[model samples]
Target: MTKVLLTGASGLLGGNILKHALANKTLDILPTRLGGDFSVPEAFRGDKEILPLDIRSQTWLWNIISQWKPEVIIHTAALSEPGACEWQRETAEAINTRAVKFIADLCEHFGIRLIFISTDLVFDGTKGDYLETDPPNPLNFYAETKCRAEEIVASSLHDYVILRTSLLLGASPQSLRSLDERLKADGEAGKTMTFFTDEYRNPIAASVLADITLKLASGNNRSVTGLFHAAGKDKVSRFELGEKLCQKYGISRQFYKGARQDEVTLSVPRPKDTSLISDALLTVMNFPMPSLDEMITALP
Candidate 1:
């Protein structure tokens, strides 16, 4: 059985991948974490060893690198919250940049393939559907670090795949639904005038996105080894997504007062438009990006 080591295994994206891995019982899924006590969740119902890991600690990580020698290493752990990263610069750099490069260097030393999960935030929203060749114009510190991390992984390792994904939706410990819930809660509590219609993203459902990540990791494809966009086909604004959710679940979108991004007091400046349109991924998949309506059906 092929053994795979996945960091951030308890996270939204990592959880989805863990689900895919568990279903293939023939494969050995070695998930890592310092805390949290649960199987990867959903379709993945496997035994665990509650591995104590802190990727930032070079000594501990290198030990695992030399011992584990996993064929595939999916690195997803990071301080992803943009505002949080803005305030907590040191922690963000340690987790997002330093730790990633450490693993990339290890991969470079020992022949291994590493799949890095990156974000669409790397672009400044000056444009959408930014290609792999596009120059990253990060608007915030979080995006800046992520963009740098991509470079670190690419230049550091020979066998690696860096996937730049857009807004993700699905259930997890800290799911992409966090933004929606925050808005919904704020609105319900009589807090209004804080939603943005100007900010745009091409969000893909977790279940669907998981398959794409796996496809990129399954085998060696140097052509697809570099950065690639992984997102949904349709691009929609935050307002539209909110409205669709309301319509789907029979709720009201009235609470959210639509405003432009500039009006908001976000610690990190957000990109105005970043709706990825990747024909690259579609060509490889048997069934490409799933429609929003189809996604709703798949939601738990």
Candidate 2:
């Protein structure tokens, strides 16, 4: 069995990874979340316990690494909110960038492979269908941190896979983690949801991402190391995605509105088109990338 340590077990992708890992007999997984009083869905609470870990603390991280000695460390924890990252720059750097550096160092020292989750936001949306070779031009602090973390992972270890994904749509243990869930919650609260019509992304289902990530972590494909795009096949606008979700869940169109990126006053500037070309990873894994319609249909 491949002993795996999964960080950010409380997040959408990480939680999904934990669920899938639990079902896989080949993996003995340890899911870790930042120490807190947060409540997780029962589905994520499998036979294995979710350990409390503050990746910000190097000592705590070192102890976990030394004690567990996992063959693979799937590091997914990060300060993902753009506004929050801009407002709390120090905390974001410490969590997203510095912690990743620490993890990379540990992974190198212990000869453990690392699978780091990155974002498509690393590329300035001027260009869509980004390849792994595209130079990252992050527009916001959050993206900047993730880009830096990606560099750290790449430069620090040869046995690392930096998976850059776009907007994720799926159910999380916490209802607010995924885009669809957040939209549903907002619509249920009788709030008007406005999505940017100009902003585009190749959004993938969290389950799909988890499947690919676990497959990489399975130690069955050591040759898959390097940066790979794991987004959806459809390059869709945010407004289109929201509309689809509304249609799928029978939510009234009245609650949803489409506005251009320029119309809204955001705390940080957003890229216009961050659609990714996931052909590289999909081709290698022999996996089919799903479309937005297919993903929406599969949504629970």
Candidate 3:
């Protein structure tokens, strides 16, 4: 059985990945923690071995990697929230930039296949449908850190795949609510939320990302090194996504407000359209990426 180490296993994407990994008996999944408010999903309580991991601590990371010697490490733990990242720039750099470098260096020395999960926000959003070959021009602190991490993995490690994904939409564990779920909860609570109509993203299901991650990890695609844009098939605005979700789950769309990127001012500069086109992944994997409606339909 292949041994795999998964970081940020308590996050929405990481939790979903952990769920998918647990189902595969051939792989031994070790979930690790970095920091943040995260709880182990009830279903994964007895199934996974939770380890305390501080990616920033080089000595600790080295010792753990040397002892466990995992064949693959899916790096998902990072300061993900754009707003939070903007507010705490130094902290974001420590976790997202420095920690990633530490992990990549270790992975390089150990010859471990590392898959660094990145965001579509890495692009400046001057244009949409960004390809793998497209140059990254991050707009804010979060994207800057992520972009720096991607560079470290690319230039430092030989056996690495940097997956730049789009906005994710799916059901998370009961302990942690997903973005879509949060929106729904806010609406139900009679809280009006303004979604961006000008800003767009190729949102993907968490399940789809989990499946793709596993496939890449359990493979002989040594030639598949470098960056790959993994996202959904449709390009939808935030407002449209919210409207669709409301219509699907019988939530009220009246509470949903639409605004353009220029109309609103945020602490951090947001990309106008970071929509991705995963043609390389699509051609290689030949797997179908579900549409927004399909993702909503499969939601529990």
> Pick by TM-score: which candidate is best?
2
Global lDDT scores for all candidate models: 0.75, 0.91, 0.85
**Per-residue lDDT of 121-191 in model 1, one digit per residue for the tens?**
99988877677778889989899899889999988887788888887777665433344444445555665
Winner of 2 and 3 under lDDT? 2
Q: Superpose all Cα atoms of candidate 3 onto the true structure and report the RMSD in Å to 1 decimal.
A: 1.6
lDDT of 2 by residue, 132-161 (tens): 888999999999999999989989999999
Clashing pairs in 3: none
| Residue range with the least summed lDDT across 10 consecutive positions in model 2 | 39-48
- Please identify which of the two predictions, 1 or 3, would achieve the higher lDDT against the true structure: 3
Model 3 off-target regions past 4 Å? Answer: 36-38, 174-177, 220-223
Model 1 clash pairs are none
Query: What tens-digit string does per-residue lDDT give for candidate 3 at 1-300?
Result: 878888888777888888888888778888888765556766754556678898889998998899999999998898899999999989999999999999999898999999989999999999998998889999998999999999889899888888999877777765335767887787678888888998888888898999888888885554577789999889988888878877776777677789988888877899899999998987787777777788988876
Sort order, TM-score high to low: 2, 3, 1
Global CA lDDT of candidate 2, please? 0.91
Which ranges of candidate 2 are over 4 A from the true structure? none
